[model samples]
Target chain A: MTVVATDETGRATPVVSGYGPSFAEQQPPRNERRSPRRLPRGLRIALGAILPLLLLAAWQVATAFVPAYRLPSPASVVLAGVDLAQRGLLGVHVGISVQRVLLGFAIGAAVGLVLGALIGLSRWADVLLSPTISAFRAVPSLAWVPLIVLYIGLQENGKVAIIAIGALFPVFTTVAGALRHVDRHLVEAGRAFGLRGVSLLAQVQLPAVVPAVVSGLRLALAQSWLFLVAAELLGSSMGLGFLLTDSQYNGRLDRLFLTIILLAVFGKATDAVLGVGERALLKRWT
Target chain B: MTSTTALPVSFRGVGRAFGTARVLRDVDLDVAAGEIVAILGPSGCGKSTLLRSVSGLDAPSEGAVSIAGTAVGPVDQRCAVAFQEPRLLPWRSVEANVALGLPHGTAKEPGRRRVAELLELTGLADAARRRPREISGGMAQRASLARALAREPGVLVLDEPFGALDALTRLRMQDLLLDVHAAVPTTVILVTHDVDEALVLADHVVLLGTDGDLPGATVRRVVRVPGARPRDRGAPELVDLRAELLAGLGVPAHHTAPSTAQLSHQETA
Candidate 1:
């Protein structure tokens, strides 16, 4: 029986030809698209470039039919970007937006993790804080602009605060839920051996919830970017949001398209970085 | 170390209840130092609850449980438990999981050596560097046993440790368990539902059954297996004993002729 099974999978080249390729040949080849692991570095890069190239081609074709003033060509957007780069305003705006995102994300995630632990670990904290947070979360990110600007007098603090507020809820909810629902058997096993309170939490509970928390952090990061525009809308002198508004006020379709594209690239880049870090950290456990 | 000193365990009038339901009632048993005892019963008979109380993971609501004359508290360092699931940390390698069984402040060199010794004893030395996810089910279970024995605790409590394995693996694990017992000689409290397993591994077999009057399951009887280490599975004495245990479990065991291990299935059918 074992010999027949082996022959069917391994050496029976023609007997099961109607069933498609033998199991050995069915194994993915080095450069097959589905088996990207063994693909050469240049081919992998070309594969990644295909979708953006197609999208750019479609946009360029669309621009020819649309009114030039209403929708600028991709080449016009590139020219506008070059024009901004000559004046150095593009670098300053991009740097400022990145700075705001970093500041807001760090503060929001730290507080979210602490608050999540507080509510998750204690019934009293959950009862005292969760209702107010839920209520606050119901208000839109745009709605917070006036209140934050009024409180902080329309400075970087107000902008950063709105982003932080936007980032908090997802991180808080994910971490709290994950920590609350950790595997009880793992805890029992930890304690059954010599693990005590803090040690048990450090060795078992914290590691178990880390994957969930990292995912929450990723969601919070995307939220921070979404609120970046609304955050800077509350009176700002510099940033991608300010540049976007300035380009719209002057009716520079090319500049507006360029700024939007820049935001997309920035958001995608940051998310990819976070994903890499998460994969590295979770590699040992999952 | 304290683990080298085998500890006697005693339960006196122990009873436990959860909210309105009582799960164990007036349960009492005494296990001598270094003896192997198996608790056998049908489902919902509170066999697991009794083992949990012994490990101090759960408290008996009515009476006290003592280990070597000391009352069990919230955590009993003298006992190490290997639950049914391997329960190894996916993050840690097999050797590291076993090292967790060592006392927290154990010196680095001694702890490493002890973990290595346990890995060797459990036949997991080759797989020590592998994480829990990378090993087979039987290998993972063996690693769990290695962890439980890492601290050299006086009492080793296992809650159906081999219940999750395939038949061949389970038999191999059972034999490996006996080999481990011969080498270490710690008092073992094995909770199981398989009659043949209890007979093969234990010095004494306990049956827990619930009565209408009692709030929880109580010990029905204790049968002492009359043989030495590495006992014969096909012995006539064990055949009768298996029949007797089957009868106690309410399975009709009228087979007086030479019986095989399939007696339970035949009787139930």
Candidate 2:
């Protein structure tokens, strides 16, 4: 409450709030200032399909000009693909492959996540099981093919088990890493907010690990495809992989090429689905 | 300790040491019903430790911490805490994030209703559809505050809630907090390093500083804040009180004299 009379005009100077003038906060960084973006309605869908269309066009052009024996053109592949489809061979093959992958992938992911969580959650668990997991990771997916068939045989169960073993480790490792790496500050904050016990894990801890889990699932999906193909190659009466092997043995280059194209399309299609699911679930997150 | 019924919370002779580093020693605090007590101290002075003790995140090495007539151990719905950062579940929508504090389905209907009411109170109703990442820091923090409020608890603990915000936003938040205090009047314990923030927001400003011999520092003085809600900073007594707090905060003597430019700027803005 001091009023000093030290002004040049011999008037009193009033003491006021020390806080400086609040200017119109300057416009923020240009990139930070960008307006929200949206793809024009239906444009996203159209744009997504464009690359495939172009690729298919190029494949058709190549096949039309080149020898059937070398490239076997898109038209011939489609004809082969359709011919295989009508004979119930394609459907049966696709069904067996899909079944093998889904069955193996589901079991593997479940076991992997639970086991990984146990290891991640406890130092003792990590000490005991961590080495075992790392050792198994070094063993290639195909290496399990002979052992799995020897133990479980050429039955569906055997193939499924092999795929599961192949897919499981990556999912497990990633989930563990995700859970381990999730910010501890967040967990502590959850504790402070009166969320203890089961609620704490469900509300706070579990969520922190989800993005990583989704990423793991994406990887596992890829492994499932790889495992399926490998399993079918080792021994299978059906599946695209079996058909591919069967066609190559018979010198049906067109059918073999057709299966490769089918495999690529299917792999991409599955990846697209996973990407969509991930986006939908994570939209609210960040 | 004998008059425990009058105070909702009390920390008695509490002390904590981690490894060789002692964070707090022989500290005691009491929060009566419907009062705002702010702890102001430098970083690492153990104000946060004390706050954590009150919530039972860390147990005291020596004595006891009691909340709502119960001893601290596991956390419960009786007390809610907000940190400087908004610790919202990123997977949830703004509305769902607020609702998560409500017990499972106890939050189902009431949670939805409260989310709306609370969002409106926090001026975040329009952002209900957005994700945590889709919002500004202030808005995300607003959602966090709303989430904490969902439990309708008797005790609210805040650790430098607005410390991360810009000055203008912090000012607005301070006013909003005062308004919230007026409406709900819960017993609030706010921790801050800024002396003016403590003065403006607390009913009692507890100064915790390192001049004490204890590792976590000790509560050296507790100043009783006077007057009603929405106190005018321009009032003569308030000006003096601010000067005293600024002195405590080590504001330079030259800068201690209020700048005339600020007053003129405030008028124009």
Q: Compare the candidates by DockQ and give the number of the best one.
A: 1
TM-score of each: 0.89, 0.82
Segments in model 1 whose C-alpha atoms lie over 4 Å from true places: A1-49, B258-269
Per-residue C-alpha lDDT of model 2 across residues A86-135, encoded as one tens digit per residue: 98788888888888888999999999899878887777998998898888
Interface C-alpha RMSD after superposing true interface residues, each candidate, one decimal: 12.7, 12.5
Give lDDT for model 2: 0.72
Lowest-sum lDDT 10-residue window in model 2 chain A:
A8-17
Model 2 lDDT at residue A195: 68
Backbone clash pairs in model 1 (N, Cα, C under 3 Å; residues 3+ apart or in different chains), count:
0
Candidate 1, residue A60: how far the Cα is off, in Å = 1.6
Superposed model 2: Cα runs more than 4 Å off: A1-68, A122-124, B1-7, B68-70, B102-117, B125-130, B212-214, B249-269
In order, what DockQ does each candidate have? Answer: 0.20, 0.18
User: Model 2: how far is B91 from its true place, Å?
Assistant: 2.8
